[model samples]
Target: AAAPAAPARASGEEIKSPMVGTIYLQANPTSPAFVKVGDMVEVGQTMFIVEAMKTMNPIPATRAGKIVEILVEDAQPVEFGEPLAIIE
Candidate 1:
């Protein structure tokens, strides 16, 4: 018998967070956020930037959809696999 395949992911939705660090909504306190709730996002588009150990990293969207929610606030600390935002 053949081995079973992995289950498929849900359709039309994605939540991407691939690291553990401080998630920032804006590049700086005075700047606007990369994205906001209800904004339409495309694959590879930056959702937000995270700061860890003085280094900044941009988190990109994995799928194209409208942002349903923002899970973190400005300067909020986040962990691995944390839900940064929900898109659908």
Candidate 2:
């Protein structure tokens, strides 16, 4: 199957995975997602976590902005520089 097209980036910023890992959209499975499309996020705010080498690492927004789209699914394996979410 063909890969999904690149998501539109309004501000041209994305929260990328720092290491190869599995992405978690919430603190826990039952908890609400850390963010959703259209939610406003601040700099240093915890957006999501990546489990690498059995460690959960929080990913933060480098700048404050509204979330335009979520590019990753919960528990999905992600690579370094992969777009996790689009913020603008």
Question: In each prediction, how many residue pairs overlap at the backbone (N, C-alpha, C within less than 3 A)?
Answer: 0, 0
* Global fold similarity of model 2 (TM-score): 0.87
What tens-digit string does per-residue lDDT give for candidate 2 at 25-69?
A: 999989999999999999999999999999999999888999988
Clash tally for model 2: 0
Q: List the residue pairs that clash in candidate 1.
A: none
Alpha-carbon deviation at 62 in model 1, angstroms: 0.6
**Residue-level lDDT tens digits of model 1 in 1-88:** 9889756533345565688889888878898899998899889998888888888999999988998877788888888888788888
By summed lDDT, the worst window of 10 consecutive residues in model 1 runs over 6-15
- Highest lDDT against the true fold, candidate: 2
Clashing residue pairs in candidate 2 are none
TM-score of each: 0.80, 0.87
The 0-to-1 C-alpha lDDT of every candidate, in the order given, reads 0.81, 0.90
What is the alpha-carbon lDDT of model 1 when measured against the actual structure? Answer: 0.81
